[model samples]
Target: MATEGIEAVFIETHNWGKSVKFFQGLGYQLEFETDHNSGQLRNGDGPTLFIAEVPADRETPLQLVLKVADADAFEPGDGVEVVTPFEDTHFGTRLATVRDPDGRLWNLQAPAEDRS
Candidate 1:
């Protein structure tokens, strides 16, 4: 399937407040936030940046998220491993995660169908 472009960059942070402040210092405007210790920010027309707090035991990595026409239809090239199967998210998006040969995570996302 064709890619729409980058949807967002996902960052796992142990210190959510500090990370959000750091981005805000860079002029990123807060888009929205959830009580689950996560939020979305944007700088002008650029791709959105998503920050979420992760467990201290978990490794925090920057995730590059690609926007596709359909997340369920994504087919990874050779050497790419599926990390998370495509699923509908609570944020009204369908998404999946894959790891490249270098172990960098890539998230694929598509707008979920409106249930309302």
Candidate 2:
């Protein structure tokens, strides 16, 4: 419940290249990129977006990262299902994932030094 506003969102695309290009036309630039699959884009300090290509049949969704005070304390409720428990991330953060009632997944995260 104690989280900052959403910091980023990942929108899985069946055609990752096209999505990236489309956003590029709108002035978004690559923030972090990987040739393997996914990349993040940013427009100033506003929320960044990550795009990735995945099989169309894959049921898993892209994530929406909500900055939280403590990812470990975020319990599942209000029609939400905890899919992954909080774990230390390589990017200096604590993270967990959950699915909302509408089937949208959200990634609960906290900065490394905030509260792991």
Candidate 3:
């Protein structure tokens, strides 16, 4: 596995305020928040947490973010299926999705390539 381990956990919640509070209660510090009720939190040297607000009717599952050196150069080995190709995210990172053998989807994150 070329992955650099977990970078962050992507969490979707209908109650953004509650969710943010819950994580904060766990000792996570708010790093920065967006105007759209989404924010990132960090707890020491552990992986960061990204909380995003979603519609109540939306059924988004929690996703683990795997860090990679380069999203465009990532390779899904063996039984891993590529769910989504690497793409630019609104948060200024490159993201890709892959499904493991157990049918769980994971997000691969990498620093955005300098297009300059």
For all candidates in order, the CA lDDT equals 0.87, 0.79, 0.90
- Best by TM-score, which number? 3
lDDT score at residue 71, model 3, on the 0-100 scale: 76
Per-residue alpha-carbon lDDT of model 3 for 4-102, expressed as tens digits? 999999889898899989998999999999999999999999999999999989986798899999877777787888999989998799998898888
Better of 2 and 3 by lDDT: 3
User: In what order do the candidates fall by TM-score, top score first?
Assistant: 3, 1, 2
Over 4 Å off, model 2: 59-62, 70-83, 99-104, 113-116
lDDT of 3 at 6: 98
Candidate 1 per-residue C-alpha lDDT over 14-104 given as tens digits, one digit per residue, 9 for 90 to 100: 9889999999999999999999899999999888999999999999999778997866666777777889878899788998888877887
Q: What's the TM-score of every candidate structure?
A: 0.79, 0.71, 0.88
lDDT ranking from best candidate downward: 3, 1, 2
Residue 104's lDDT in candidate 1: 78
Residue pairs in collision within model 3:
none
Which predicted model would earn the best lDDT? 3
Candidate 3 segments exceeding 4 Å error: none
